[model samples]
Every structure is written in C-alpha cells, then in structure tokens.
Target: MTTPLKILISGQHGQVSRELQQRLGDLGELVVLGRGQLDLSHPEQIRQQVRAVRPDLIINAAAHTAVDQAENEPELAFAINARAPGIFAEEAQALGVPLIHYSTDYVFDGRKDTPYVEDDEPNPLGVYGQSKLAGERAIREVQGQHLILRTSWVYASHGKNFLLTMQRLLQERPELRVVADQIGAPTWAGSIANSTRALIERWLAGRAGAWGTYHLSAQGETSWFGFAQAIGEHLLANGKPCAVLQAIPASAYPTPAPRPLNSRLDCSRLAREWGVTQPDWHSALRECLAEQG
Candidate 1:
C-alpha cells in the first residue's frame, strides 16, 4: 500500500488558492495555510512554519496580485511576490520536497505580438510584473525541485475578477467601457486548478525531472471588451437579466499600473510534456458563471 502524498497550499482566501484546495482535496491529505496562519511578508515565518509541517509538496498560491496597487506599494509587492517565495523555496529544499509556484504573464513588456513562452526574455512594464518576475528568478536560483507555472488573466466563481465585475455591471449599467487593446487568454482558477492537479500527479509518479518553469493558460485569446461582451452574451443566452454593451479603446480608462498589451501565453510545452491541456477560457468562464449562479 502506498501513502497518499501530503501537500500544503498557501493563501486559502484567494482564487487560485481556493481552487487548488478544492481540486487537490481527494488526491492527497491537504494542509492549507492562509494569511491568518502564515504571512508571506514575514519570510522567516514562512520558512519556520513549513519546516515544522514538512509536506511532500508545497503549492504557493500567495502573491501580491493587485497590479495597479503594486505600482505605488512596490515594497509590499516585493515582499509578498518575490522575497517570500524565496524563503518557501529554501525551506522546501531543506525538506527535500517539491515546490510549485505560480507566476503571471505580466512578466513581459507588451511589445511582442506573439504569445510569450517560458524561454522568452522578460521585460516587465510595471512594479507588479517586475516583482512576479523576481519571484520566478528566485525559484530558478534555488537548488530545489521546483515548478514555476506561469498563467494569465485568472478568474474564478468567487473573488472580484473581470467576469464577476461584468456580471454586476451588466445588471446595473447600460454600457461598459472596456479596453480592446489588451489581448490574452482569460484563464479560470478552476481550470488552472485542474491542470495543476494533473501536473502534480505526474510529478508524484516519479517524474520530478520535469520540475521546471512551464506556461499553463487557456486555449483561446480575446480582448477585454470581447471577453466582457461574451460574458454578457452568456448571461443573456442563459436567460439571465444582463444587457450590457462594451466600448473599445484603451484611452477610455487608465490606471497607475500598465498592463501588457499581449498576454497570450504559449502553453504547448506543458501540454506536450505532461499531457496537461488547459481548458478553453470561454468554456471555463461559462462553467464559472453557471457555478457562481
């Protein structure tokens, strides 16, 4: 008889964190640690707590994900995104366990028209992106079995993401101002969690050599305007009270944090290597909408 793997996940309140907890529930004995139990800002505490628990797998879903806010609060962003993950990695290495880290597509500048890959050179435009990139670097430098999975435009049934915001606006407002300039895959946390579980399962089956950076995103890409329109349409088609139209052009709205114009991530390597094909973004969103309702 084989023992089920013991896995630890951080940030239980966040979208990805919660999704992972639910997705990986039956696969192993899950030990969750939220900000109440662990603070990433205090790196020492991260190290100490993990050392005591000694989990077989450590999934890091905690991050400074507020893009615009990170520009003003660079120190806090760095503390959570970059510095904290380094401590987690170091402790995982000491325990001889595999650490799974999540990264963002914002690690690149919006200049490239193509989908960004794992080997691509990163030139983050804002503090949020830079901080996430720093965390990726930290994981690579650490001499441990680590997997840095880069994803983009993550949403879920819970939390205040683009889909939920649109669901509200469609009910309250007549027209929405959405930027059509940005293009990328809108990934659902539920979908990402499914993909993550498969990858971790493969890793547990004596495939630790595959421990490295890989891009895992949805299949399709669309602008925010298109995405919002689709959500509105989904609600409409499903006989829900939602009637909202979107206006394009980036000039309509501006923010302190600059987003990447191109957020499409090439996820072929992850699929080919581990047979982990992320679900289509729209399909995932529709499921999220149904589940949320």
Candidate 2:
C-alpha cells in the first residue's frame, strides 16, 4: 500500500489553515500546529517543532496579518512572518521535503496600473508587507524546494477577515464607508486551500516540474467598496440585515499602515503553469455565504 504523505501545517485558527485541515484530512497524515503548540515569534520553538514533526510536506499558513498593528510592532511581525518562515524553509531543506508558504500582494506599492506578476518588483508600503517580503526572500535564499503562493484580500466564513467583520458591522451600523481606491480579488480561503491540494496532488503524481512563486487568488478584481457592496447585496438577498455601503477614497480613511491602491494580482502564471483556474470572486463569495448558513 502507498504510504500517506506526512503533512505538517502551521496555524490552526487561520482561515486557510482551517480550510486546509478540512480539505487535506483524507489525503495525508495531517498535523496542524497552532501558536500554543508552536509560537512563531520564538524562532527556536519553530525550529524545535518542525524538527519534531518531521513531515514529508510543510505548509506554512501562519502569519502576522494585523496590517495596521504591524506598523507599531515591526519586530513581532518580522519574528513571526519573516524569521519563522526562514526557519521552516531551512528545516524543509534539511528534511528534503517541499515547503508550501503563503504570501500577500501587499509586497507591491500599488503604483502600477496593471495587475502584479510574480516577477514584479516589490515595494512594500508598511512593516507588514516588508516582513512578508522578507520571508519570501529568505525562503528563496535557502535554496529549498518551495512553492510561495502570493494571494490577496483573503476572507472566509470564519476568522477575523473582511467578510466576517463586514457582516457584523453591517448589522450594527446604519451606513458604512469602505475604501474604494484599493483594488484586488477577494479570494476565499476555501479556494486557496483546494487549489493548494490540487498542486500537492500533482506534485505527488510527479508532474511538478517547477517549484517557485505563483499568484493564487480568485479571478477578477474589485475595490474594497465594491466587495462590501457585493457582500451587503448578498446578505440582503438572503434575508439578512445589511447596511448602506458607501464608496470612499482611501484618502478619506487614513490607516496606520498605508495600503496599496492596487492589490490586483495576475494569476495567469498559475493557470498556465499549474492548470488551475480559480473561480470568480463573486461566485466564491456566494459559496462561502452558503456554507455559513
């Protein structure tokens, strides 16, 4: 009998992590570690835990995702997002296992009018972006077999994401204003997890020829305001209370960390290389909402 792949994933409560846990259960011997089990801020702990797990595949889903908060705590963010991932890469290299890491589109400064490609030069606008970018570079420098997936505007039915936050605020507030300047795909965590599984399956089938960075997000793009409007419309259509969504420029809402105006990612490379075509953002959103019910 073929042995099930031993997969070690970092992060427990994260949207992607949770979805991965549900999706990858039957395919592998899945072991998920949360902050309680493996504190990412402590690099030594990360090294220890990964060594102990000794997985055949390492999927890093944990990250310091508090964008505004990262500005004030750059060291903590770097420790978790940058330092921890490098350690994982090193461990994966030592174990001779493939490492799967998640990154963000915030690496770009949003100055370009078009969607960002994998080869695009990163110009982070905040500490959070810098830390994530640092992690990407560190993993690459380790010369380990890795697949770094850069996604954007990730959300899910659970977790502290835009979709849940908006759902709560819409019910509480009479009217809401969302930033309209920032543009990107509102990718569902479920979609990301499923695509990841497909990639792993291909790799296990000995079809993975390249191991590098790829943009994995929902197809098409929308601004924050547009996303919120869609969410509100979806909620109202489902007989749920929704607030009046008003579109406002990013300038109107000053955040601790300057957000990229254009968070759009060009996922053509992933489609061309991996033959993975992501569903539209709207369709994915509907699935997420339906799952919530």
Candidate 3:
C-alpha cells in the first residue's frame, strides 16, 4: 500500500488554511502550523519547523494581509510575506519537496483595461504589494519546484473578510460607502482550497510539469460596491435586515495603500492546465451563505 502524502500547511487559522484543513483531510496526513506553533516572521523558526516536520509537500497559506496597515508596518509585512516564503522554499528545496505558495493580485497597478495574465509586469502601488511581489521573486530565485497561486479579493463565510464584515456592518449602519472603481473576483476560500487539492492530486500522480504560477479566482469580476450590494441582496432574500450600500470611488475612501482600479485576473491557464474552473462570484457567495445557515 502507498503511504499517504505528508502535507505541511502553514497558517492554521487563516481563511484558506481553514478551508484546506477541511478539504485536504482525506487526501493526506496534514500537519498544519499556526502562529503559536510556527511564527512565520522569524526565519530561523521556519527552518527549524520544516526540518522537524520533514513532510512530502509544503503549502504556504500565511501572509500579512493588512493592505493599509502594511504601509505603517512594512518590516512586519516583508518579514512574513517576502522573507518567510523564501525560507520555506529553501527548506523545501533541501528536502526535495515541492512548495505551494499563495500570492495576491496587488502586485499589479491595475492600469490595464483587461484582466491580468500570469506574465503581466507587476508595478505595485504599496508596501504590501511590493512585499508580496518580492516574495514571489525570492521563491523563483531558489530554483525549486514551486507553484505560486495568485488570487484576489478572497473571502469566506467566517474570518475577517469582506463578506462577513459586510454582514455585520450592514446590520450596524443604516448606510455604508464601498469602493466602486476597484474591480476583481471575490473568490471563495473553499474554491481555492478545492483547486489546491486537485492540483496536488495531479502533481502526486506524476504531473510535475504543472508547477508554475497560475491565477485562481472566481469566474467573473465586480467592484467592492457591487459585491456589497449583492451581499445585501442575498441577506434580504434570506429574510435578514441589511444596510443601504452606497457606491463610491477609491478617492472617496482614502486608504494608506492605494488600491488597484482593476483586480481582475484571467484564469484560463489554471483551467487549461489543471481542469479547474471556479464558480461565478455570485454563485459562490450564495453557496457560502447557505453553508452559514
């Protein structure tokens, strides 16, 4: 009998990590490490933990995700986002295991009229984006087998995400203003986790040629305002009270970090290579709400 794959996943309580824990349980022996067990900001700790776990594969789902806060804490962001993944890559390379790293769409400046492709040149607008982009470069420089999955506008039924936040704020406030100019897919964490499982299954079955960066997100795109409106409508459909969603541009909501007007990512490569296609953002959101019920 073949031994189960030992999968080491970083960021235990994160949105993606949580979903992965649920999705990947039957496929392998999952050893998930959180901040308490493995602090990613410390490179030495990362090396020590990986050496100790010595798993068959490494999936890095941890990241410093505070876009505006990253401006004030660039060092912390870089330490976790940029430096830690490089260390993980080095350790994975030494162990002769492949690494799967999650990245963000913030690497782009959002100037393109169309969706972003994998090969698009990145021009980040803030420290957070720069740090994530740096992490991507650092991992590639290690010359190891790694898959960097770049996604955008992630949310889940739980966690500190746009969906839940909207659920709360819609009840608290009579009206709320959300950015209408920025566009991207509101990808469900479950979608990402399921896709990751499929990718891993294929790789373990000897499809090593699939190792590369891919854009993984929901099928379509919408602005923050549109997303909020949909959330409110969903709540109302379910007999819940929701606030009025006001559409505003990025300029109206001046954040420390400038947001991209366009965060849409073209995910044809993932569909072509892995046969993984994401449900539309609205459909995913509906399913997530049903799960919450």
What TM-score would candidate 1 get against the native? 0.96
Q: Per-prediction TM-score, please?
A: 0.96, 0.98, 0.97
Worst 10-residue lDDT window for candidate 1 reads 202-211
Query: Ranking under TM-score, best-scoring first?
Result: 2, 3, 1
Regarding TM-score, does 1 or 2 come out ahead? 2
Per-residue CA lDDT of model 3 for 73-154, tens digit only, reads 9999999999999999999999999999999999999999999999999999999999999999999999898999999999
Which pairs clash in the backbone of model 2? none
Candidate 1 per-residue lDDT over residues 112-144, each given as its tens digit: 879988899999999999999999899888979
Instruction: Identify the superior model by lDDT, candidate 1 or candidate 3.
Output: 3
Task: List the candidate 3 regions with Cα displacement exceeding 4 Å.
Answer: none
Distance from true location, Cα of 48 in model 3, Å: 0.9
- Model 2: CA > 4 A from native: none
The lDDT values for all models are: 0.87, 0.93, 0.92
Q: Which 10 consecutive residues of model 2 have the lowest summed lDDT? A: 1-10
What total of clashing residue pairs does each candidate reach? 0, 0, 0
